[model samples]
Target: MTHTFRPRIAASIAAVAVLGLLAGCTGGTAEETTEQTVTFWTPQATPERLAAQEDIAAAFTEETGIEVEVVAMAGADQDQALVTGAASGDVPDVILHASTQTGAWTSQGLLDTEAAAAVVDTLGQETFNEHAIEAVTLDDQISAVPSDGWTHVIAYRTDLLEQAGVEVPTSVTELAEVATTIKSELGITGLAFGTQAGTASATEGIQSIFQAAGCDLVVDGEVTIDSAECTEAAELFLTLRNSSVAGDFDVTSARAAYMNGDAAMLLFSTHILDELAGLDEATPATCAECVDSPTFLADNTQFVTVLDEENPAQYGAILSYGIPTGANVEGAQQYIEYVMSNGYVDTLGVATEGRIPLRNGMADNPTEFIDAWGALGIGPAHERTSVDLYGEEFVGGMAEGINAVYLWGMGTDDATLAGLVASQGVLAGQIEQLYNGAAAEDVTSAMKAAVEEVQASL
Candidate 1:
């Protein structure tokens, strides 16, 4: 993956010259005379991940004769880059990004909804995760092609819970009680989750609680963050945070607390699966017992995929491929189709822990990709499949959960507004206010006002 930005101006100028020559000689379309090249911007920029993407691109090129230039872009910098590219008409042919940006990008006229929908149709919509596809849909059109997604999980130490005589939590109240008991009996942090404001972890952590409690941020283009359910959700989130380690915990610190044996339960994405299993050397398990058994934590951990028995929802984030407005539509579609089909398993194998396959399989074998994904190895060092670490039942449950995962503004008329609200961290900031001892009503009021402000701006 190359970080060096290549302006599309040069390519456009050269393409025009080539078209002129082709018109003068053969009077044929550019597609008939010249090979196509698709520019792909991806945020998965680590060396290992980039190499995997390059290999996938190479394979696609071999099969389709369409060249792909894989560019490495940081996820944080992608928004500004997209804005700049859209303004200059120099955007990449296709972009791999979070589903939260789909509505906003489409509303700004940056993405080509028709092109994305065409790819979805070509690949067979029935093969992809319905919830993921729904998230990227706006105005009855697919804004992007859903790629992969991971759900936030409630991971508890089975040994610690059994020793404390507590059952796994299934509801908000029970979860809080379990955390409290663990803290009192084990003398360890009861729970670990992100509390830092304006971070992805905090935003996602609170949003999961809200979704599980049936709280709505936007409904029919109206700001509905000040409702009773949202207030209750906020209070519940605060209760969990209060039981966590002292001070603010971002994603990294929270994971560390749990892996270091300082916390008994963790609220994080499935990305932690690799680290918890001692498969990633950089973030290896360091629990006291892990010194003797590297996978001690992995063996003793149990994940709660869905909480809040009444509502029954799980928080998840989906990644998608969005073709830009002025891109090589045909070539981009070809590349996406290839990756989602023939190259699907290898592409997802780059980081199996985080990249849950959104596309299950081909139309003929709808469960192929899902089954293969369960067998794909995870972690950077000494890889092992989730099926090997956890059982097939556990892995299958995770696959099923992805189809019903929840996100705040998805599947609503005001999805664009919801995207803007999420991108701006409106609710995340409100979570911080709760952490600072502000009343839940006041926090909800502030959140409602902030969302209204964003809606008004739009």
Candidate 2:
């Protein structure tokens, strides 16, 4: 797919057309007609993803007679583009973005919370995942329509664990013990995860463990990273890091280690689902047994969704559709409703492995979309449904876990502040300190101070 960053030229053209219509109309029985088009900005800019979105847009236009001008925005450049567009009153009518940005954008007056709430009401709020809806809500106003999401998981080699006679870990303490035991027994890396400072992968890796430990970075609009829970979480995360492959591990290296059979367990997102099945040619399975059967690792792998037994939670990334303040409200609402209903499955099918359905289905059939999601084909080479690969039982468990996925400050007054602090990699930097032998108490104190500085800057 081609990546293009274009200005809102279509909005300008529409404005000119509207002016022409107004000038030409006189005091007569004249029927002034114009096409309704919703400008949509999406960060899913890959060629394949863009094509899938275009297909959905085309269907929406055919059914509703409302044109959708889909704009591809690179994920890295979307924030800057949104800021500049909002300043010039040239923003798209609708935007598809990560849930992390919804609160911040709404706080900046770039999003229309009332319009979003209207869409939710029109579509029946009960149809959507309650947690997803809550994630994009601020001050009782829905800032965006939840589209899709995925959770982080511990993908482990079931075969190795079975041989070692060790059950899967369910808490931080058990996880560390399992990792240490696996390494000592098997003479291989026990866990593979990112540790690189200032990287999103590293931040997410630690954040998942941190949150699972019942520690909240921000509570009641105050920085709480210095709590006792945070200190214990930090210490446990360092132990996990110590058990991981010794090196500068990032997302790529960690996945590579697992795919190449160098690690027994991998802390990664659900996006690795297809790769585990040896479907992506670029990163095919390279495990020893994979030479004979590329899917050997997949067949021997199992996913652990929740790690904390006492405080069970799963870290996730949610993508949503947001209507901007100056958007064509009517057209945007129609489009969002259609995408969440008739076109919902196709939208999620863009990348089934990562796009878990947030809106379950119509009120009549709550599991309609959830069931379809499990059956959606995945992988670039030989497509196969997740249900076909992992079975229905596992897929259902994942869907259930997604309903209560956790993020640092989602659904809170300080969500924007928390997002800013997370983006700055404060937690990851503090994690690096832990890796370097800093006391957990000291690291937690530094994390609290850094988060406070970020909050003050806002």
Candidate 3:
């Protein structure tokens, strides 16, 4: 869980990026490198999906004779390695990464925006989901080729909530009440969320709650961590954790808790629906209640995209690929184009449960991929599913949900992102302290100080 890249504490992001450009390449200039081969680093996908990616790359090679080296890197690890590789001037030709990293890395001048834009244009910009394009665009430049997207939601056990006699929560205050009530009535953890210090999950946990409280870590390019709204958000999180959340919550633990029926509610990505429904391979839930219980996919869960509150929004992140400035631009562009075209269906087919296609269509058909994704049949605990578990309404909600994604420092420049990333640990740690019995006032004060520290560092 140790991170190699600490954006919050990065000394000089611009300097690091420039240094990477000047010194990071493995050995020779672009002319000296082999034209037949291009290196690609992919963010970690499921084993099946990873294998599918390799297959797609291989097929691309078969057609074009340009060999692609597919390397899988986990999320945080990729972040660390990319920064390190960039610093050493040894980055891969193309990297598949999260949308959040687009602004940061592009600002560092690590990404070739001109090359990315060309590919997007070649593929036709109108073919993509507008949100996908917006996610990767910064300062009027397309930083990366948008790939897939993930929608965040507050997923809850409908049966359990009903038993606890609580209504579905639509606001931060209402959610807190529901969590407390569920815990007290059911004698189970009411909420599960990642609070692990110094991890991406922790950052996500903090930002999700903070947004619900109507606070942006940065407002109009100014640090607003000390604003009244942010403080209230922190206070609200402290109150919830102290009353109903597990003290040791992290992404893995939180998901496990929900899957095992040990938690009544979980804040998670849309992918959890696949897990809750059970995969086709006959994986069973570890929850004792699941032995003879109804499947969670059987009208036992509720998915919430946006809360009904003053500042309503849900958290989401996009996946994308970009060519580094010093790499094989032609090969990189070709590979990206292939993924968006010839390989599009097969590539997204592997994880249709979670990957909402950013490129919603092809030249001939506007809704081809989107429709295919909607009807993707795979999961099976009892009967197989087609991601239509909750009906077309749920699917439409998710499609709309992608556009509703908002996070702290979103749409801002890289400097603000640096502060946001750096302060993630601070916010996470403070929340954990509250869970461990720290006073709310103290936690809020600490968060304010930590936020200031991150902003100062930037």
For every candidate in turn, the CA RMSD to the true structure comes to 6.2, 5.8, 8.5
> By the lDDT metric, which is better: model 2 or model 3?
2
Give the higher-TM-score candidate: 1 or 3.
1
Global CA lDDT computed for model 1: 0.79
Clashing pairs in 3: 8-422, 23-89, 24-88, 24-89, 24-90, 25-89, 25-90
Each candidate structure's TM-score, on Cα atoms with residue i matched to residue i, is 0.88, 0.91, 0.79
Model 1 per-residue lDDT tens digits across residues 147-233: 998888888899889988999998777787898888888877778988788787788777877878778888887788899988888
Give the per-residue lDDT digits (tens) of candidate 3, residues 40-135. 777655555566677777777767776677776666666677777766667677888877677778888888899899999999999987767877
Candidate 2's residue-wise lDDT over 226-257, tens digit each?
Answer: 99998998888877777765576898999999
lDDT of each: 0.79, 0.79, 0.69
Candidate with the greatest lDDT versus the true structure: 2
Judge candidate 1 at residue 331 and give its lDDT: 75
Candidate 3 accuracy as lDDT:
0.69
Question: How high a TM-score does candidate 3 get?
Answer: 0.79
